[model samples]
Target: MLDGQASDLRVFALGTDRAGGMATAAQILGGAGTGPGEFQRPTALSVGRDGLVGVFESTGRVHLFGRSREGELEHRTTFQFRMDIEDGCILGHHLVVTGLHSEHSGVVHLFSTAGEWVRSFGRFYDTDNPWVSETIERSLVTCLEGSDEILVAPLFLPEARKYDVLGNLLWWTEFDGLRPIYLAETADGMVGVGTPEDGYHGTIGVTGDVDGGIAILQVGFITRERRESGSDPEISTYVLAADTGEGALLGRDFGRIRDIDGKGAVLSRGVPFPTLRVITWPPSVRQP
Candidate 1:
């Protein structure tokens, strides 16, 4: 699962092994199409509070669909662009898309739910500051629940950043070895998982029947930041370790986690054979 949303009657799954197909609680919607409601290389999916589903295809298009009375996908509209979209999320009546250009610069574009382009800001590069250059190429965008802020994770930088709705950078922290690929926020704090840049591997028991098994160094952590009056936020980081029985859970390629009810998380291990697992926190240490 890439991203999923649940309505009163059905659940929606995107980027499964089905290839450009959107799966419902009972059936699949569209798959690998250039025609209406079809997708080619669907990269991200998000559902709004009103049951509207937004699917982002790698070919620079977004298809919006609604659930039918019979619990099926009903094609609504398509948002088209020229740049390659890396990831997207639905924020209320707005859609947020992030991607890179031929010039090796990153961008974040906002659009209306109706597919109207809003405004874009990014490609933050300052030749005078090498630190600023490292923060330019953002690869993921997700909304902070119940807040007007959005979090973005860079492709190569070991930092996750927060920005206001208008694209002003409010706060950021450097997580030395983690190269985050996904982000989710909850009432307690924000949780993220990513590949460890440093050669750090944890010993988890083997699964299936592979000899010597594989050591997975994927990192998951919960971070809490406190912003005081007229001061920068104080950041606290806790690195999480995988349980023994977890067993190569994070070794899968292109893995992501999403929060659930502030207690557990839904982990989606991507590609080849995709799998979804629901994991609880504390002892599990994998809270979305």
Candidate 2:
């Protein structure tokens, strides 16, 4: 989970039983401070296949931790930067971090897993082309395991871009009026949730009212199909679901989706008292 509270800086791991049932809290990593293992505002969390957890703090510090035999977090190493980090992710032994210097400029910094600097790219606000300017606001970065491909979606732009390990632009696609908020890789390909720039304008379910509801968004999937012979890859798009001003389902209000699993996704819903809702994919159709 993302640790935003400066008073209680930690990366918590919720436990699960052998039968996939909810268990006790497994472990907690880091504390509040500016030390090697402490945090000042851990904003992003990513777990690597090697069982290491990378925590990116708003203080421009990155900490790496591993699980001990007793299920406790053991601090490994840490790195620091100058800019305020917006988001980050781990790709194998590489760490990619996006930082914002001013209102219009940002950069993506790459580093080795051992806390050594690699290379940096993308300048802020200079949108000359795809390579030079990144314009990452609320940066969202995701790495496709074993593919050496990374996906980045900046809030200010309407497109989600793909880049290689060397920071080369691969391809990008527009999401129409939707602004991508979260991205994840699935068995089929990649799935993302985009909230409508303006509130929902379509028909309100059953009520026939035009007043836009609190929740209305789109979920899209992108599948890459390889060619039989030597040719460019073919990509297919699917609109899994797009809410048209539906109020709530199963007594739960709708919010942004956090993570997607095989059969469904985990949605962060409600306010004042935030709660989680595990919803199956291709949600049931709302009656008009």
**Poorly placed runs, candidate 1 (over 4 Å):** 1-25, 101-106, 127-138, 177-255, 270-272, 279-288
Local accuracy by lDDT, each model: 0.52, 0.52
* lDDT (10s digit) by residue, model 2, range 1-288: 544554333443432333334333344556677888888878777777577788887788888888779867788888886667877878888988776643323456677898777776653244433222332344566554445555565544544455678877765445453323333334554343343433221111111111111122223222122122322212112221112222223221234555443345555533334445555545443212
Task: Report backbone clashes per prediction.
Answer: 0, 2
Candidate 2: TM-score?
A: 0.60
Alpha-carbon shift of residue 192 in model 1 (angstroms): 29
| Residue lDDT tens for model 1, 156-245 | 445445566787876654545443333333345433344333322221111110121211223333222211122221122222221121
Over 4 Å off in model 2, which ranges? Answer: 6-24, 101-106, 123-138, 178-254, 261-265, 270-272, 277-288
For candidate 1, give the lDDT.
Answer: 0.52
Residue 283 in model 1: shift from native, Å?
16
TM-score of predicted model 1? 0.59
Q: Which window of ten consecutive residues has the lowest lDDT sum in model 1? A: 203-212
